[model samples]
Target chain A: MSAALPPFPKPQEALDAPELLQVGSGAEVDEPCLRADAARNRARLLDAAGRLAAEHGAAALTMEGVAAAASVGKGTVFRRFGDRTGLLAALLDHSERKFQAAILSGPPPLGPGAPPVERLRAFGCALLRRSIDELDLLLAGEPSAERRHTFPPRRFLRSHVALLLREAVPDADTELLSHTLMAYLDAALLHHLTEQCGLPPERVRAGWLDLVARVTRTDPPA
Target chain B: MSAALPPFPKPQEALDAPELLQVGSGAEVDEPCLRADAARNRARLLDAAGRLAAEHGAAALTMEGVAAAASVGKGTVFRRFGDRTGLLAALLDHSERKFQAAILSGPPPLGPGAPPVERLRAFGCALLRRSIDELDLLLAGEPSAERRHTFPPRRFLRSHVALLLREAVPDADTELLSHTLMAYLDAALLHHLTEQCGLPPERVRAGWLDLVARVTRTDPPA
Candidate 1:
């Protein structure tokens, strides 16, 4: 599958360029201006909160829980995030940044060192995993219908898929196709399939690969 | 394209059956118990409201406009539907029933008596057209993310698509693929593509046909 496709037109430079990889919506907490130590403290707090969310669900996440989990004072957690809503937003923003970094520079398949098809497959799987892990947080943060597609994080991710699809299926309607591809990985749909319908994660993962192969007109990796 | 595929297996009976075509969510205005003339009056009022919504966006739809358009007293409109919210719900219910009737027994292609793949193509085009016409109403009525896939009207439409996909590509994951196909016709997505991105309706329609073709692995009709 890898050799059958042309190399992704210009994987590294095109993907690595900061302009192409900006996922921040500007509404998230400004990180660049935070002093180094404060930024470290925030990151550590978010890490603890992320673990709490993954283990106990986002609805169960609390500042006090994160504080105790991170061995920080409750006041410290409060001083950092302000309220539960702020904590939730910061947690999502933190995860989004980490996921964006992984796509831009982390490693092969998911990052930029593999065939576009492989990367596309890897991307969906990784996103599905993340969605499953933070379903509550994602659902709670879902934008209104009018704003859902226009949301910056969504636009950024959709653009990334469009870029990959352009490389894999040059003749396709990549913009529309990217939306279809992203729809398959939608948080709402994932919740319905996994939580409501009881579809196993493996089945959903397999469906993603199958869908990518069908859209790209390639055989699924055996 | 129609002749290339097998005839839709038991199209008329399968699709015509009331059980297979039920679209009501039980929350919409109940119509069965209304007196005959009263039902006709309600339908007439809804017809006027539908036109009002389609011509001047759903936001502009009002009891006064509908009463004037239907040549009925304002109190009649208010009495039939309790308020603007009730009017909106009834308008949507009226359209849903009409659309359901079309798929159940109305005509070839969209109804039955056509190959499954052709029906699938026709289904998407018809849906996109309807969605374009009632974009606001649909978006306003969009269920929350948690309830989205489980909503009865949505579930019925998805089941319809899944049934078509079953006949068209028996080996594929029709459940997941049906969701993908329906996602293309989502009101929010349509709003984004046409209203936000400024794509023409014909292009969005073309994308639907292309998506159906790709998903079914069939050649698009010339």
Candidate 2:
């Protein structure tokens, strides 16, 4: 807890953090400013890096492995990402874009075509899956405790929950309710329950459904 | 994070940690071995320390201040608790015991006589008040995230909430539900909301009531 740099910067100041689907804002990325072929190369490297992370955990992702996976030179990997920290940040931003896109417009439950309660359930499950798949990546990427709630990705996720909660429970305090709901899905708690306490994915998912029902005043799905 | 010690130790390892009220089993503590006058003296010192924590916050609760407040020598204060860390640990244990005692037997809503849901609401409000009052002390004493869920003081508090949740929502998953409820009153979260976000204490207290109602599927108090 010294001057050690956090893997990611504050959301508003995270110049490189992908702008996660800010409603009404189109294409909020830093616009890499690469030529078409170079941009395609960058995407390829990130995609390969992501696969390595998902398959072997983020801790296993190395610049050389990324270069080998993408069939690029190790120097190219270093030049592209600066170091392991840079690669991880880009990896999170890469996955966050996909996640943001899915929640914004990709499908039914998590996107626009489902009930608020259903959306809430889908959102948590999706996040849980991602957290599990990218456990080390996320735990490493986590901001300091003081900045955790205000981090951009976190803000985006919390707002999404609040929106659905407001729709699902107009009579309740949805803002606070959203915080309560999001707390269940926190990275630290998830790590404790799943990895430390050895709860399987199904139990965690079931808990999420039960929680959504309790907060939304709905029956759990049959 | 390095091996550099946090201001506090793990609860179980905290040699001087006050024994919390263990349900069904009764009081579990390292009983102070003292004669009547010595025990009274120890209590007086602890009481003075608690007053200092409550009045000026725990950061200001120095051995010198406690000695002056309790009309004892500084050497007596240090000898009684070993050092600053020892004194703080003892102070927290002292507070934890009082808090546990209140919930177990003190009176209506916060204690055993009232309904579980009522007790749950009162528990959060009371905890939020104490967390706000002892924000610095609790924040410094927070266990590392990995051990947070299993920390003895935290486990004691969570179990108490779980017991109430069992009675209030027998149909639900009380274990996970207790975690949800506890998360809302977490010392770090409370500090962020009150000290960082500037939410008034009344708002936080109201939010707690709303959360209890939502999780319990009851109407908020009008």
Number of the predicted model whose TM-score against the real structure is largest: 1
Q: What TM-score, computed on C-alpha atoms, does each candidate reach?
A: 0.89, 0.79
Proportion of native contacts kept per candidate: 0.44, 0.37
**In candidate 2, which residue pairs clash?**
none
lDDT of 2 by residue, B1-222 (tens): 011212222331233222356421112243555777978888999888888888888777789999999999999998888877778888777778788889878996998899998899889989998889888778767665667777777778888888888789886767778889999998877877778766677777888887788789897776
Off by over 4 Å in 1: A1-21, A24-29, B1-21, B24-29
Per-model tally of clashing residue pairs: 0, 0
- What docking grade does candidate 2 earn? incorrect
Query: RMSD in Å for candidate 2, one decimal?
Result: 9.9
Off by over 4 Å in 2: A1-31, A59-74, B1-31, B34-87
DockQ of each: 0.32, 0.21
What is the DockQ of the complex in model 2?
Answer: 0.21
Across the candidates, what are chain A's individual TM-scores?
Answer: 0.87, 0.85
How well is each residue in B30-147 modelled by candidate 1, as lDDT tens digits?
6778899998998899889999899999998889999999999999999888899888887887788888888889897999899998888888888888889999999888889998
